[model samples]
Each structure stands twice: as structure tokens, then as C-alpha cells.
Target: MPFGGKARWGVRSTVALLAAITGLFLAPATVPATAASAKQSSAAKALAGKYVPVMMIRKQGENLCDTKVEQYQVMTVDALFGNPDVRLMRNNGSSKSTLIKQAPTIDDVRNRGEEAYIDLPGDPLGDTCVYSKDFTRMKNEGEAPVAVYAHIAREKGHSGIALQYWFYWYFNQFN
Candidate 1:
């Protein structure tokens, strides 16, 4: 279920939003290592073109006593840049070499900050949505204040930005 339409923005509430986010128990994150130039190129190649997210992928409890996940359904590979009318790549200096035809709706965004936090739908831990890194940063209208797209490595191999202290070694392992 992709979130349709872009929310009307430009209200200019940086200070207010910051306070609200903090009061809500949401904390900001640090920037990720790995130079911007390298990440930009690589992330673009991996995400801007193709990305998809699944609701569940056979979950398993870390301990033997935990229960196992049963649902593993998938949704359409929705575009994550922005609405069709808005152009996000042009703002980021990536005018060509794209794989997404239409930008994904708000719900389609899987976040693109190095150490920022994006409030995706579902109960935190981001509801397990996966998309391209490039598209995650791709902005629609000057990027949202919450869309503070940066790069982070979450300790070890965790290659995604987040608002909280994501336990890198625990669940974000690529191996």
C-alpha cells in the first residue's frame, strides 16, 4: 500500500518540528562514513533504478524459544523518488541514467539519510520496507524536513540511515 500524493509543505517549521519530534521520543542520528562522492555513485546505482520492499520475509526469533514469522508477501516495486509531476533527480544533479519511471508516493519512501530517521508506516523498526538507496534520497519538492537524507553504516554492514540507534550487528547483517 503506497501512500499516494505529496503532502502540501513549505510551512517552515524546522524549530517546531524538531521539538515535536524530540518530544515524541524520536531522536536524530549521526552521519554515515564512506565519502559522499563514492556513496552517491554507488547508492545511485543500487537504488535509483530498481528497489522493492516486502511486508515480511520469514521472520525468526534470535533465540530458539521465539516464535517464527509466517507472512512473506510482497508489494509492487513502487517508484520512490516522488510524484510523477515532481522531478527529484534533477535537484540532486542526477539528470540521466534512471530506472524508475514514476516516483513512489510518500509511503513508498524507504528513507535515504546516512544517520537520519524516517517515519515509515507501521510500528517503528521501519515496518521492514526495502527500496533503492538512491531513490530514498531522491527528493520531490526541495526534500522534506524529515527527508534529511544522509548516509550511515549502522556500526558494521548496516547500510541505511535511521533516526534511532539501529543495532547494526543484530538485524541489519547482509551476510
Candidate 2:
């Protein structure tokens, strides 16, 4: 029951959602070879517009349990991609991270580009309170909290594809 019952849960709707979420829209159907592709892309974008979620964020500066967790921002994957401050890294199998690129694009991520993970600026072993504070500031600087990464995965011998959504957060305080 997401999107306030505006978008239905179905294969076609899912495709539209994918197009919208990924920001990949189809071109015009002027050419004979790309007629179908253009039509589908246009339709998907139109339908996806209704499904965009209106996030409800907690009041900023609100304190609860001696913490200001409400100030955390919920951001989009587009916000993270192409961001100069974010670094895309890959593991070198020796407990070392190799820098693949700075601010990899969504297309790079969708295409399974070189970078497997993104490294934030703060130190992981630093104090929790300090990390939280720095993360909040970082969030305000350019990053938001929630960026969803989705892909269609097909298991071997499986009947259909699985729409997988991975929600990315900057810092997990509860962890």
C-alpha cells in the first residue's frame, strides 16, 4: 500500500517505477525503429510521476532520548551520485580499498561499474557522538539520508525476476 494507492502493484507499473526511480526516460517515437521504446519510456515517466513519495521528515533540532535523531535528512540516490565529496571505492582483497572514482554516476552504479562501495569522509572507528555530529553536518552540506538502489535479480532456475531495493543510509547510529 505504498504511494497512497495511486500506483498499482503490477509488472507494467513496476517497469514504470523503475524508469522513474532511475531517471531514465524514453525518447520521442519519431523513428520507426525506436517507436515502441519511445512510447514505453514516455508512458512510464508519466505514470512514475504519481508514485514519487512525499517524505515525512521529523522536525529538525527536536531532541528525544538525549539525541537529535530527527534532524537526519532523507536524500535521493541522485543526490549522492556525482557529488564531489563522495568517493567510490572497490575492495582489493587485501583489506584495502581502491579508489575507483569520485562521485560515480547512477549509470555507473547501474551498469555494475568498477566501484563496489562508496566511502564517506568520517572515520568509522571515531566516537559515536562525534560521528553522528559530523554525519549530520555532512548531510546538510550535500548528502541526504535515504538513497534507494534497486535492480532486477534473477536467481538460477527461478520463475521470475526479483525487484530488489537497497536503502542506503549515511550512518547507522543504531548499529
Candidate 3:
């Protein structure tokens, strides 16, 4: 299912959206042979790290009832799906989850956009404390610190290059 209102799109950790917009002006109208090769260089990949958002977490209220865990993480898509506890759930009428082949690879993600999510164990509406602990445990279990999937558009004869990055988070906690 669509992540509902819990999904966050914030300035702190969403540089892809901003960089993509900047690329519009910075990218040349046409890439020459040399320029095309340079475009494929490590510089483009390096830019993703530079552009990765610096997420800021707000503290939970004194009662801790106002919110769940204040921690928000950006993890490698693989680290999430590769974890045994993380299940690849099909977004459908039925709640049954399909077995992913050791979790989907980057190529698989490109092929199956929005088709599935790495669902952590526990109810989506579970207690905030429980979710908070689970998130902590998952992080402690060696989840990757960050991941950004970058794609340089490959359209034949395309005028300008379109650089895009896709970030996958463990959970999209709106609160």
C-alpha cells in the first residue's frame, strides 16, 4: 500500500529532489562524447553522497506518548530486504507476502518500482515503544548507514542528461 501520511519528504534528508531540479540547469543541453564519458565518471556517483540529506530527528515528548522513536534512518535497499526479519510484502488486496529471492537486487528494484516494501516485523499500528525498540535492534544488527540508487538516464539521442537518485528507508514513520 502507499505509505499513507507517514512517509516524509523533508529538506534534511532529501537532496535527490533538489539536485534533480538543479541538474536541469547545470546539465548541458547536449552531452558530447567526452562529456558523456565524464558524466559516467565517479563524479556523478560522488555527487549523490554530497547531496544526501542531513536528517534531523525531533525528541519525543517527556511522556514519550507524543511520538514513537525519533530516529529516522536511510539504509541501503539491500540491507533492509536482506535482513531475515524484513519481509518483502506485495501491495495488494491479500496480505500474503511473497518470498523474494534473497531480497531484490538494485536491478530488481529498477524493474519493480513501488511493487513491494521491506516490512519490519510488528504491526504498522503497534505501540510506539515496541516500534522504537525494534528500530533500535534493527539498526544495531548492522543495517547500512545509507544508500542511494543513482540512475543516469539512457535515452538514445536524448538532449540533456537526467541524473536521479532513489533512496530506500527502513520505515516511513510520519510521526
Q: Provide TM-scores for the models.
A: 0.18, 0.49, 0.54
Off by over 4 Å in 2: 1-38, 46-73, 107-110, 113-115, 124-168, 173-175
Clashing pairs in 3: 13-53
**Candidate 2, which ten residues in sequence have the lowest lDDT sum?**
7-16
lDDT string, candidate 2, 124-158, tens digits: 56344554565566666755534433444446565
Model 1 TM-score (2 dp): 0.18
When superposed on Cα atoms, how far off is each prediction in RMSD? 20.3, 7.5, 9.0
Off by over 4 Å in 3: 1-39, 49-54, 59-69, 95-115
Error of 1 at 79 (Å): 16
Residue pairs that clash (backbone atoms under 3 angstroms), model 1: 47-132, 79-104, 80-104, 113-150, 114-150, 114-151, 114-152, 116-162, 117-163
Pick the lDDT winner. Answer: 2
lDDT for model 2: 0.51
**Candidate 3: Cα lDDT at 156:** 56
